[model samples]
Target: MEKQILLQVEGLSISFAQYTKGLRRRNLQVIRDLGLTVRSGEITAVVGSSGSGKSLLAHGILGLLPYNASMSGEILYKGQELTGRLLENVRGREIVLVPQSVSYLDPLMKVGNQVRKGRKTAGALERCRELLARYGLPPDTESRYPFELSGGMIRRVLISTALMEEPELVIADEPTPGLDLTAAKRVMGHFREIADEGTGVLLITHDLELALEVADRIAVFYAGTTLEEMEASAFQREETLLHPYSQALYRAMPQHGFQPLAGTQPYAGDSYEGCVFAPRCPYRGEECSIQEIPYREVRGRKVRCIRPELAEMSGSPGKMDRSPDAENLALTERGRMA
Candidate 1:
C-alpha cells in the first residue's frame, strides 16, 4: 500500500545575490527545480557530498534560509502549502530538525532545560524525560551545560530534544557526522525508535552504506537537483542505478564505513560543465559539454544524467556535483561554505 504523504516539495529554487559593489547585484541560482517528498513511517535518506545542497534543502523546508537567499517553490504538508512565517510556525510542530549543529541544547544552559523548552506541553515534557532516559542519558544531565558533554553525549541530547516533541517528521542532517562508531550506533538507535513509531525521517548524509543499512528509500542529489531515488535494499542486491551521480556515489564510498570507521570522503566538487559530472564521467561524449542532459528510468528510479549507463564508469563518486556549482553557496558564505 502507498504510504500517506507527509511532505511534498515542488520545483523549489533558491538564489543568491552576488555583490559586484559598483554594479547591480546579480542573482546566482543555487538550487534549481529541486523536488522531493517524505511520506509517513518512511526513512528517506538524502545523500550527496558536502555542499550538494542537502542541508540547504532542510533549511528551506523549515523556512530558515538567510535573509539574502530568495526561494520559490511549493512545499506541502498534509496538503497545506508552506512558505514564509507560516512555514516557520509549522516546522517544530509537524517537522523538527536535528541540525548539522546540535540545536537541542543551549551551550550556556542546562541540557534538561533545553529539552523541556522544546516540549511545549505537559505531556511532551513527560515524554522528554522518558526519551532521555530511554536513550540512557540521565534525566539529571539536563542540569549540565553542553560544553561539559562528549560528542556522543551531545548527539544523544540533540536526539532527545528533536524527539522530545514527537513531531511527525524529522530532518536529520548527518546526525552522527563526527561521532565514533559506537556512538553512531546509539544515535541511530534513537532514530530507529522514531521510525518504528511511524515518523517520517529525512536523513541527510554522504554515507551510502549507512543509507543502505537503514533507509527505506534513498534520494541522491547533484548540483542542486535530486538526480535519482530508489529502494536502499536495491543498492545492495544489485547496481541497478539510473543516475550517473548515484552510481558514482556508491562506488566512491568506503563500503565498510557504516559498520566500522574507514576511508576518506571524496572532495565535494572538482571540475565540471553542462552536466557537471562531465569532467569526470568516463562515458562522456562531446555532447556532455554541449548542454545535453540525459535522464532515464530503471525500475522505480528517475535519473538526471545524460548517461545513466556509465554512472559508475562515467564519473568519480563521493562528491557533490562540482560542489556548490551555483553561486548560492549557502545563507551566508561569510565562513566559506565552499
Candidate 2:
C-alpha cells in the first residue's frame, strides 16, 4: 500500500528584499533548497532551532509570506500546485495553521466567536463550547476576549481554532510554547489522533523529544535548509542518525548527554557556498566548503552531506565506519583551526 502524499515542498527558497545604507537594496536569502513531505495518516515533524526558517516554511506553504519576501520552487497540496488562488479558497478550511503566537487571536473578538469564525448560530456555538471543554476550558471562555485569557489558555484556544475546520493538512508552528508538559502532550496526542484519522500533520517545533514521541518521521533543519530527514525511530540511537548536525541535536537532548555543539549557525544574510554546516562540522574538508553538496538519499535517509563514506554505505543497520579520509579531514580541520 502506498502512502498518499498530502503536501510536498520541493526546492523551496525564500528571500527578503531589504534596503541597506545609502538606499542600496539587497536580497537576503532566508531559506534555501528547503524540502519536505507530509503524507496522509502520518505526522512529519520539522525540528530546528529558532530562526532556522521553520515558521517561514509554514508561512510559505500557505502562500502567506510577507510583502517584501519572494519565493521560488513548488508547493503542492494533494498533488496540485498550492498557489494563491487555491490557498485563498482552502487556506483556513482544508489547510489550517496553529500559529506559534497567541497574538493571532483578535483582541476585539470573543473567544467563542473567534473559534466559530464569527458565527453565532446555535450549532456553531455548541461546537465552540465542545472544543473549549475538550481542551479543559469552561463554557464561559467563549464570552471572554483574547486579553482576558492566560498565556497557556490562549495556546489551547489556538489549537481549538485550528481544529474547528476539518483540515486535510495542519501546519502547527511551535504550538506548545506556553503549554505545560501535560497540556503539550495532550495537544500532541490530539494531532496524533488527527493523523490516525487520515489527515497530514506538519509539526514544526524545536522540541525534538516531543516530536519523537508523536511524529513518524523527523526532518532536521539547519541554518536555512534541511540537513537530514529520517524516521523518528532512527533517533533512538546516535549511530542510526545520518547528518552530523542531527547527531549533535540528538546528543544535546536532556536524556542524552546534553552535550552542546560548538559554533553558531550562519546568519540568514551571511553569504556562503557549499554545506551550511561545514563551518562547525568536525569532518569538514576543502570540498565541503567549496563544492555545492547535493541533497541525496543514503541509507534510506535523505542527507545534504556529500561525504564519500555516507554515499557508499547501504541502509543496513549498524554503526557507520568513518572512512580514514574523513578522519584525516577532521584532523586537518583541527590543525588549521589551531
Candidate 3:
C-alpha cells in the first residue's frame, strides 16, 4: 500500500525585515530553500542546533510567522495549497501545534478548561481526564492552573491539548524540553503511538538520539537550511550518511564518541553564495563556494549538497531523481531503497 503524504513543504524561505542603525530597512533571511515532507503513519523529525530556524519552519507551516517576517515557497496540505483562509479553518481541528513554549497555555484558566476548550459536556470532561491520565497527570490536574503544574506536567498538558483535537497532522516544536531522559523517551513514545495510529507527525528537536528512536525520517537543518534528509536507520552507521553535517551529528552522538564539529553555524543574515556548510566542510572545493547547489536525490535520499562523488564513494551511486519545478520538490520516492 502507498503511504499518503499529509504535508509537503517546498523551497520554503523565511526572512525578517529589520531597521538598521540608520533606520534603513534590511532583510534577514533565516530559512532558505528548505524542503521536507510528512506522511501518514510516520514521524518526520527536523533536527538541528540552536539558531538553525527549526522553530521558524514550524511557525511558517502553521501560518504563524511574525508580522515582520516574510515567507516564500509553497506549503501543501493533502495535495492542496495551504492558504490563509484554509489554515484558519483547519488550524486547530485537522492540524494542531504542540508549541515549544509552555507559556502558550493560559496562565489564568484552569488546565482542564483549556484542554477541553471550555466545554462542559460529559464527553469532553471524560476525554480530558483520560488524556491527562494517559500522560501520568493525576485526576486533580484538571482543577489546577498552569502555574500549579510542574514543567513536565505542563508540557504533558500542552501535548494533551494538541491530542484532544484528533488532528491528522501534529507539529511538535521541541516537545521534550525540560524533560529528563526517561521522561523525554516517554514523550517520544507517545508520538510514535500517534504515528502508528496513522497520524502524520513533524517533530522538531535538537536531540538527534531521541529523534532516531521514533522518527521514520530525519531532516538535518543547518544554518537555516536543510542539508540532508535520510532514513533514521542511516544514522546508525556514520558511513551510510550523506552530508558532512549529518555525519558530524552521528559522530557527536554519545555512542559514536561525541566528536564535535569545528566552527559555528553562520549567522542568519550572513550572505553565502554556495553551500552554507562549505566553510567548515573538509572536502569543500573552490566550486563549492561559488556554485548554486541543487537539492538532488542520492540513493533515494534528499540532499542539498552538490557532492555526488562523495555520495558515490559512500555506496549511494545511482541516477538522481530531479524535481520538475520548485512547487513539487521531489516527494521522496516511496518504497525506494533507503
Q: In TM-score terms, which candidate is top?
A: 3
Ranking of all candidate structures by their TM-score, best first: 3, 2, 1
TM-score of each: 0.80, 0.89, 0.91
| Candidate 1 lDDT, 1-338, residue by residue in tens | 99988888777888777776787787767676666778889888887666667788888888888998899978888788886666777677778988766554566887777877744677866787787788888767767888888778788777777776668999898886787777776676677678879999988876665666677888876667677777777576225666654554555445513111122222333334567556544465787888745444555565667666665443333332433333243322112111
Q: Go through the candidates in order and give the clash count of each.
A: 5, 0, 0
Clashing pairs in 1: 112-142, 281-314, 282-314, 294-305, 294-306
Model 3 earns a TM-score of 0.91
C-alpha-based local distance difference test score of model 2: 0.82
Ranking by lDDT: 3, 2, 1
Candidate 2 vs 3: which has more TM-score: 3
What RMSD does model 3 have?
Answer: 8.3
Give per-residue CA lDDT, model 2, range 39-108, as digits (tens).
9989999988766678999998888899999999988898889996888999999999998876898889
Query: Which residue runs of candidate 3 sit more than 4 Å off their true CA positions?
Result: 311-338
Q: Model 3, range 1-338, lDDT digits (tens) per residue?
A: 76899998889999999999998999999999899999998999998875568899989998999999999999999999998788899999989998886689888999999999998899999999999999999999999999988888888898899888789999999988778998889989999998998999999998888999999989988888888888899888777888866876765676876554555678799998898988766567789999988778887989988884674365321222222442243322110101
